[model samples]
Target chain A: MKARVFIRLKSEVLDPQGQAIESALKNLNENNIKNIRQGKLIEMDIEAKNVEEAKKSIENITVKLLANTVIEDYKIEIE
Target chain B: MKARVFIRLKSEVLDPQGQAIESALKNLNENNIKNIRQGKLIEMDIEAKNVEEAKKSIENITVKLLANTVIEDYKIEIE
Candidate 1:
């Protein structure tokens, strides 16, 4: 199975990197931009018994290793 | 308007960061994992006259500033 995990900072969390990117974009003349949030996308192939199992494993993997749950949230898509 | 841009390394590009993450996952006992490609997702709100203009501007921004087109590719979703 193939899984894609999108990990993003929680709304309340401060994202310095995002801010830096926003400023960079503005300098690049993207002056109309706002609320620029940056995140991570992880694409992985996994061996799983079934879709349900894959989902469970992916949830665990994301929560435990892929994202910092205190500040980040992750969503998984499996195929 | 809102836009989400996904930036990823081209298939032929070597990603040391992805390799390190894969090894780390293996160390964490995620033995079933493979092809662990890591990418970036940027979400932004933009003031645009129309969707067509937004798309064109985003294309230019991505190619010129957001992604290293020599080794990476980017896709944009506008809403």
Candidate 2:
């Protein structure tokens, strides 16, 4: 199975990296944009019996290694 | 409009960060995973008349600032 994990900072958290990107865009005259947020996308192939198993496995991996639970949230997709 | 940009390394390029994560996962007994790739996900709100305009604007922003076309590929989604 192929699994995807989308890890994003929680909305309430400050994202300085994202703010930097937004400022850069503004400097380049992309004035229409706002509230820019940045995150991580992880894609991998996993050996699993079914989609459910893959999702579960990936979820475990995400919580343990991919995301900082105190400030980041993650969503998983399996295919 | 809401725009999402997914920026990923080209398949032929090396991703040392992803490899490190994969190694760590293996050390933690996640033996079922392989071919791990990491990418960036950027989300923002933009002022546009319609979805088409939103996509075009985001595409321009992505090409100009978000992605390094030489070694990375990017996809834009607008909603």
Candidate 3:
């Protein structure tokens, strides 16, 4: 089974990296850019017997290892 | 307007960070994990008058500034 996890920073958290990218874009004449927030996308392939099992494993992995729950939120999609 | 960009490394590329994370997951007893690949998601808010303009600007930004076209592929979604 294949699973994808999209990890994003909480709205309240300050993203310096995003700000840095935003500044870089502005310097490149992308003046229409307003705000930029950066996150992570993790793609995993697991040896599972079924889709339900895969989803469960992915959810646990996402919460425990993939994302910093304190400041980031993650969504899981299984295929 | 809001746009999201998903940047992923090409399959031929070796991702050391993904390997490191995979090792960490194994140490945590995630034995079912087979393979892991990591990527980036960039969320941007731009000052565009229409969806077509937003999509065009996002595509340009993605190609020129967000992704290194040599070894990475990026997909853009505008809303």
DockQ metric for all predictions = 0.83, 0.93, 0.79
**Per-residue lDDT over A1-79 for candidate 2, one digit per residue giving the tens place of the 0 to 100 score:** 8888999999999999899999999888989999999999999999999888888888898999999999999999887
Which consecutive 10 residues in model 1 chain A have the weakest lDDT in total? A57-66
Worst 10 residues of 3 chain A by lDDT: A26-35
lDDT of 3 by residue, A1-40 (tens): 8889999999999999999988888778889987789999
**Per-model TM-score versus the true fold:** 0.93, 0.98, 0.92
Chain A TM-score for predicted structure 1: 0.93
Per-residue lDDT for B1-79 in model 2, tens only?
8889999999999999899999999888999999999999999999988888889889888898999999999999887
* Residue pairs whose backbone atoms clash in candidate 3: none
Give a tens-digit lDDT track for model 1, residues B1-79.
Answer: 9999999999899888779888888777888889989999988888899999888888888887789999998999999
Error of 2 at B47 (Å): 0.8
TM-score-best of 1 and 2: 2
- Candidate 1 lDDT at B20 equals 85
Query: Model 2 reproduces what portion of true contacts?
Result: 0.90
Deviation of model 3 at B2, angstroms: 1.6
The most accurate candidate by DockQ is 2
**Per-residue lDDT of A43 in model 1:** 88
